[model samples]
Target chain A: MASRSMWRSLHYSAKRRVVSPAQYRCFSCSLRAQDQGKTDSEKMTHFGFTNVPESQKESLVGAVFSSVASSYDTMNDLMSLGIHRLWKDHFVRTLNPGSPLARRHNETEGQGWNILDIAGGTGDVAFRMLDHATNVNHDRQTRVTIADINPDMLAEGKKRSIATPYYNTGRLSFMEANAQTMPSIPDNSVDLYTVVFGIRNFTDKQAALNEAFRVLKPGGVFACMEFSKVNNDLFNAVYKRWSFSAIPLIGQVVAGDRDSYQYLVESIEKFPSQEEFRAMIHKAGFMIPGRGYEDLTGGIAAIHKGVKPLA
Target chain B: MGAVILARPGRSGVLSSLQKAATASSRTQCRQNHFHPPVQYRKQELPFRAAPTRSCRLYHSQFHPRAPTHEYTNSQTTILSAALEHIPSHGFTLEALTLGARDAGFLDVSVQLLPRGEFDLILFWLASRRGLLRAKVEENQFESLRSVSSVEAKTKLLILERLKMNQDIAHKWQDALALMSLPSNIPLSLSELHALSSDILTLAGDSAVDTAWYTNRLGVAAVYASAELVMTSQKPHADFAAIEAFVQRRFEDRTALAEKITGFKQYLGFVGSTAIGLGRSWGLKI
Candidate 1:
């Protein structure tokens, strides 16, 4: 019976309604409100570990990324011990963006395949995609657009990309836009939509996924790479220790920001699991086959993919 | 400031509407206003539940259902093709598995996807090649031999044809053989041998069901193992004709031994029966 009550509490916790603090004074008060079956307004969501007004989530996330934009690449290397490179490489190669479409657009040059990389700050995935499509596939008609909600992040990406041949060759471009609504990207225009290590920062993850579905051409792929729940208990213990204690210290030493790194770690934990996220993709009208998500590194990170159906 | 935020509420409205639509479309029970707490907070608050267990609710959730069996087979085929490129250079090492996983775009930590590590990958490669050999034999190569050849001749043809498939990876086969030679890997090696022999026998239409079944399989396995060793030891430019000759000689020796054993067994049975009859007809008992 004790276990039963604990499970009930957990179930409630998982679906904890984000009510304004004005409605419920404290955590206990919120529990009481739930017991009384009172429904609260949807004006609250989480900011790190704190429940803040929903209006503030976007800016809070923006502040966190802006604070770490310059040190983002370095921090990623330190945090994951440079395994992120292998992950990104695998991510791009899996997409193999132009292998199929390159044939259809052989007469049209490199403009046939369009890739929209959402929240791709600093052009990590974008550069890799361009390299794979150009060097590996020998197709020059693939193009990539790196979109980020934070201008600071976009600036950092633009600065880094200025040195590459793809910078101004009409093959690569950068845009500043919220993932939830990219009004500039026309419907059914993108062939591959990728969001890497960036979806957890979105205020409305489902809305972002919906936008992904809207922008993708029929039969296009939607791929995401993100930190996921570590399935192994012992590994999870070690990973948690490293993420909470060491990562923020590394951030302070390297990026001179502690709170932002703390926020990043917190956000990763708050993100949905592989199965839940796959459901979100499905809810957005994307078709997925068989579990939809593949766990990487013992579920420390995962890749989820879905295809827009051709009706 | 508040009015400015609310004045252009287009984005929020769009988001809310989209959320509603998502909730409606999702087949699973929609959690109203579900907010995931930060991991750190959850760990501190729910120590007992902090471990990442696959939840029963998740299992029952019909969110993203698993694909059918054939889709997994297709995906495995894709992974195998990517893995083949790395095997020739890296043998069957973890490095090869890593490269293959990367080429297949598996996310980090997905090395576990090939759970038994290098052994599993080696088995997969062997099985895949066996499949290809079967297709080649059935589709085009063995039609004429099937109608006119003896079982020994058919077995020789299949073994040689399969061995030829390894020519591309001859340099890497030395490393594979070394790994397979380890004491701990004996079981896996034997299993691989059994699979190969069974596949070859099936292709050759050798359907013996008596004690000959065991002998036929063992005979083919021994012949195939010896031929593999010989082929691997041969230099790249060494006479291909010599390997064929060696295989033919080995098959002939096995056939000759089998015939001699059969002849000896028949003679022993005849002598035992005559002795029994002589004892029954003996006048000493009268």
Candidate 2:
């Protein structure tokens, strides 16, 4: 039995590969300009602060992640002063991916808990979730799939996962997929769906939310953690100055890519406020109560969650 | 805005200042990761020590979730009303919508609600105002006008009422008219025109099933669109009396032309049927 278990672990790890961006096309081009029978110039969407053809947005965002893939984790630490780890920890705990509720549901369904972590490149959220599920809930059967649109980011995550015990235990995997549509992921399959600091990069956020609603089981949970609007004017002004002026300079010095970091900052500034985002989650047919989000650090970052109805 | 300028501060100085601000305002400092044994595991092991503040509101998970459709429409309405306030100064443009949403206490991302931005809001404003006009007509039981029996009189009254309704926005309507004339917005403008004409005919007690339905609606729509163009071409200081006179004259001219076309169509139908009857009697295929 021990030998069989070891063989199974190796087989699962061997199944993982870094998928290239070229191999991954957006599954549903419903909102593409060409699909709408319009010329590229006639229908434009925002690529960071610049307006570009809607079809070109995906590749532009992909190039950004590819350029910063290797140094991404270190840059994150330096940029946020390592406070990002605490936020990730809090996010995973709040999710409680394999807590008693998940276990109970898994028991009745006769399967291990499954989590689909979209755009979770570098395995930051995945590792934290695995640790929390294993250490806190004593649930070893919990599994996670880190899906990202960029292959270079996935390669970095794969390299980092080689030393972790979850690497070959059939507990972790990675896939190249777009948030707008994941055709390979079947309906009513996931126990939890999460996207950390990633949804704003999607060109069609409503379509992505609809896809999230489709892949989850009737009682699944949807959680998102991203930069949000700060309500206090004084703090907001200071934060804006710090973000717009300093972060890109740090990126230039540290990562040697100023434009990509500039794009990241612009994307954060363009994200919806906490309440508006909660309203969007509600629009996607999830069941959320009053003020269905929690703000962290005075709305600098927030965690919004909703549950799929059992019906 | 408090402009804080530091004289020739180095990169390290900026980083240090940011660090100091972060640490003083919040306990978000990084700590060493501690992986504990199973016996030492505790729910409170994480270093999330910040107390919940008033910046956010928390709700229990068990309460009923409200559908957001109503909220979405409410926000759009608020944004439209705010946009109207800026139209006089900036005209109908994306900048107006952006400033309007901000003035309505909405964040920058509120622009997402209107994917096409200014064009979408303009269409929304027109449709919403048309709805209000219909409501007003219904409330007065069609007695708000001087005469509802004759097509010319009725068209004149409807046009005058619409101009009156738009009196506050008269100066800005010229810009809106210009935007609606763009190639991309032409279809939307035409559809709104059709809807307005249909409403006016309905208030005149004209059933849409009549043979003259399409012709009547099209005629009225053209008259309305032209009258609007003429009204907007007037100087900003022009009185409503001039607009009312222009509308009456335009209505009289179009109404005569419409009556002539309707009579010609009836006469052609009579002659064509008579010809068909004669051809059938002569054993010819009709």
Candidate 3:
């Protein structure tokens, strides 16, 4: 048994190799440049501090998720003072991800029940929603399928959930998927679409939003919980100081990893503002007829909700 | 600023010493070639669960293993090389290069064992420096990496050389011993290994943007070789500190073209490598 164990360990050890950069193309950037003969929006990407071609962003983002998958949840809580949970909760509350029961008839199954949580690693949102849904109505089955790019996050969620009070019994399921190109759920099949702390990580936010639009059922709700600018100048200054200083330190302490946290901080700095993001959602044809901004401590975070018009 | 500089002299020894300590830790672990013994004494460490890789879908073992027993190959390198095989051309444009390097850095940093050891941790730090360097070279972020004076560069080089030599020597000795031959010994204690790795990781992270500035300069120059560029860009320094000084002194020379070349290389090299290498590995094309 001992020798067999050694042999098995040897077999597995050599096979583990460093993951190289993921390969992808920015067809949109290329096509736009070629067709219009203008290179303004041609192709651009960020490598830490430098910005380059759009094609490179995908793999860089992929690597970040892989490194952070394990300590991701823990860091999130620590860095944000557990505010991220509130942000996610705010998103869920705004989403109200369930079918409204019948009005006239004795019983009417709630419509618009399917939700796709893109980049819902570890099923944080899904798990929370499961509890919320169960509390809302036991009879009406609301399915929240989490789609994340990192398999480790999904697997971790699987391992953790199995031990949780709700496992396969919960209304939550997970799938590995890239936010830009999620093909598992059929078009116009989802009633609510959500991506929390995930939008800024994408190579192309526009492409992701468009994907969200394509998958949502008409009149579906789309809500995103992400780090947003805190409006007050004083608050902004304090936040920046905390983010650049204490956040990385916290990561070092808790996760035993700081670069991953550094990336998270940098990502927040690089992310588009709430208004600019709202504009993008509008561009995706989501009517921002009504919107709510939950500035969890001066724009430290904001949950933006938009709706796809039935027409 | 004065206090900071003053503090630097006192702190420098400790930083370098910490790195040496890390080297010592790895060496010790190498000597003790067995699974890390469960600590009867608990330290203030994060509880690590089984980290899943592509093949090892589920971690069945209870004890979180520290190092992969020679079985851990650079999967990213393999994936990249496989991707490279598909691409016929060896070179790419500036933008593509930058993008590729960024992606490669991300993947490289992401896949490595978490809480990496000192030597391995330097890679990401170097990558961040490369990114910042690229920004500076592009002139978009001027003043990012001022050319260090020859003296400064030389001094920096000396320290790095010392560390690298120590690492190489330690590794060579470990390899010669076939440390794995022992069945009962554990690798280095988790505390000792993590302390050194995290420090180097910070060091690398702090300097990555700057180093990248130099590497990016090399990457974007129509020239492919780093050594060749180093030979021409600044006078040869006796050590890392001297080189840093030289680069610092040249800060004023500020040729727009030089910056452009560096910037272009950083961006293009990164993109091209990732798109051609990783993309191909994943059976995709850019």
Clashing residue pairs, candidate 2?
none
Give the poorly placed runs of model 3, Cα more than 4 Å off: A1-42, A71-73, A100-112, A164-166, B1-286
lDDT of 3 at A43: 75
Ranking by TM-score: 1, 2, 3
Query: What is candidate 3's lDDT per residue for A162-256, written digit by digit as tens?
Result: 86556785366778887888777788777678777778778888999999989876656677777788788987999899978986676556554
Per-residue alpha-carbon lDDT of model 1 for B41-146, expressed as tens digits? 3433331231112222211112333211111233334455677888867777766665665476542123433334566566667767777877777577666556
lDDT score, candidate 2, position B18? 49
Model 3 chain A worst lDDT window (10 residues):
A1-10
In the range A165-243, model 1's lDDT, one tens digit per residue, is 7988888989989898988989978878888888877788888999999988765778888889999999999999998
Of candidate 2 chain B, the 10-residue stretch with the lowest lDDT total is: B52-61
What lDDT score is found at residue A249 in candidate 1?
A: 80
What is candidate 3's lDDT per residue for B105-220, written digit by digit as tens?
32111211221212222222223233333333345343322344343233233223323332212323222123322342123222222223222222222233234434333322
Q: Is candidate 1 or candidate 2 better by TM-score?
A: 1
lDDT of 1 at A270: 82
Compare the candidates by TM-score and give the number of the best one. 1
